[model samples]
Target: MSMTLRKRAVLAAGGLALVAALAWAFSPRPLAVQTAAVTRGLYEQAIEEDGRTRLRERWVLSAPVAGRLQRITLREGDAVAEGDTVAWLQPGAAPLLDARTERQNRAQREAAAAAVQRALATEAQARTAREQAELAERRSAQLAAQGFVSATQRDADRLNTHAARQGLEAASAAVRMAREDLVRAEAALAPPAAALPLSRAGGQAPLRLRAPHGGQVLAVPLTSETSVAAGTALLEIGDLRQLEVVAELLTADAVQARAGAPVQIDRWGGETPLRGRVRRVEPAGYTKVSALGVEEQRVKVLIDIDPDQPAAAALGDGWRVGLRILTLRQTDALQLPVAALFPRPDAPDPQGRAMAVYTVDAEGHARLRPVTLGGRNGQQAWLRDGLAAGATVIVYPPAGLTEGARVQARTP
Candidate 1:
């Protein structure tokens, strides 16, 4: 073939390759376009969530002694304080309780007190005998040396002293044991604010559930006159003066939790959102199955509401609210929505700590921009380096677009 003809054929082939590349780059694809604006604003990186409201300090009211729901003077939502009598229960009718059981508890307490007294008396007697035995031992030793007492008698005296010492020790141990028993008996008689329900299915039978602490009545489990089982729930108690926001976060989210993380809460039927701070993140995790039935670990995070805010008063215990925890925040930063950002897969590693994202130059080309991302929130991220303010970036660019691919900016 002639040299001129060979050159012309090569050029034609190159032209076709370029045209194909352009067609592929120009194809349509769903993409989100956003602008990088220069503004002085606070960028908060918070964990967004929806959760229920609750009193910061609330207690359940339960029966201290077994009894039926004889009468409940306070209704649900009634305000209560310490030492206030909320309910009057019948003499008998608690789940796991009978008249005999009530009498048994009372008898047990009196018996415990009597046993404690006996232990003290026995201890005192043992101490007195020990002192006498010790004196006898000294006297017997002197008499033996002077030949006034026989060796056998001296040995008998020593043995008596030893026996008295053992008796004293045993009496002391008994006294200690009796006191401990009394403590246990008292605790057994006392009822927890939220007692483990008498029955998981039924609930704690009417022993008037009392308010564990000063708080509001949240629920009346037994309002109607119906025969309840051993573990039937009677009522619920809580204090709304103190409130906290609780969120059920997945295990992954909880692992990243910190003590001072900021949070935002949105109450149900509320117009405005409120801010909060993370007070605690539970150490333990719970089993939760995702919609796909995949087993997952979940955790509870408690956020404390700021009292300075006006919305705090409107909140109550067990009320529902939405939360946004501020995991990170940046002031005066180059922020960009994740949708408008791109990661260059084939970019070479520069120095330490460098990420790549796509930017649209005035020429309408996908410019590979190396950026340093500092912090991020739910949607937008803080760009610390490699990106300038007011730079337009291609979100989902056209297919086959390269570092220098031609892209036409859709009119805003």
Candidate 2:
């Protein structure tokens, strides 16, 4: 009986030992996660966009008259002085006339010549009438002085003389106009004069296109000798020293941009980024097709490079660069990595969304804490409430993490 009792006690001990071993094998372990510390520092919220440099003022030179343009010897990058001639344009040759057109011009000239002769004859007749009326008036004046002519007769003669003088003046004017017509008719009948070089074209000089201001020649669109009409673009000129940056931003983001805001310029193949300021946010928006095949409204934002910066002197017009426009900034603010924050479930705020983060305690346990966010840059988020400087928070928390869950911090 004593041996059977001892065996039962041993069996009971073995069963208890097996149960403890199974419990130990299936026990839960702490979840490992990355963590970061909250800190206080200067924070800036900025929007990044691509930008291009452009000349502030550019001038495009064009032909001033229809003429044969001389071959342009000036090349791009050539320095020009104000009022200096840049291009020469000789007078264009008259178009050749066909036999039919020549015959028509001859007929018109003959008609004009006949009209002038008729006017001359009319002028001669008017002169004779005026002479006859003047002689009659003189005779009537002498008779009236001697009482040989009645008062009514003398008045009639005097009116006739006055009318004759007016007729003579009108005829003289007609003769002058006829002479001008004859000159025009003779010119039309005459053959076109031979083409002359600009220097000796009847004392009239060739059209000289001069530079309106001092600048470097950017382009000469027409280089070969050819005929060009008036207002044809010939060259472009601009001062590279005065450069401004233009950035196209989405309409939604442009609304937050304001003039005089700070800008950081980068990616211009320079070691240090340049500084600039927002000069203007254009009121108009334009349609642009994005890389994703989506149409978007974009606005132009002009940025003026800081003249004091060394990169300003190195940069030239039409250079591509990157721009970071600071929309908001806060100094001495509580901020943390944006990765640490996540959307909170069933905790929607007035703004339609709420954020929460996992805060690690001294015992390496993660506790869910709701946070009010103020603003965010791409990498950092400003904390408005529910978080303080020096607090540790889990970054990119793992799935299935819960309140008061055991956690192990991963070292960077």
Give the candidate number with the greatest TM-score. 2
Query: Which candidate comes out best when scored by lDDT?
Result: 2
List the candidate 1 regions with Cα displacement exceeding 4 Å. 1-41, 56-58, 63-69, 90-213, 224-235, 347-354, 362-365
Q: What does candidate 2's lDDT look like per residue over 1-412, in tens digits?
A: 9999999999999999999998888878889899999999999988899999998667777764467899999999898976678998875654567899779877867887888888889889999999999999999999999999987577666656755665665566566556555554564455445333335537435666777556799999999999998569998887666678999999999988887777899999889999877878999999999999999999999987766566577787798999999999899999999998888786867662269999999998899999988888789999889988999999999899999999998766
> What total of clashing residue pairs does each candidate reach?
27, 0
TM-score of 1: 0.58
What local lDDT does model 2 show for residue 369? 94
Q: Which digits, one per residue and each the tens of the lDDT, describe model 1 over residues 180-233? A: 557546645655533323545455543333333456778876665444443345
Which stretches of candidate 2 lie above 4 Å from their native place?
Answer: 1-20, 93-204, 350-353
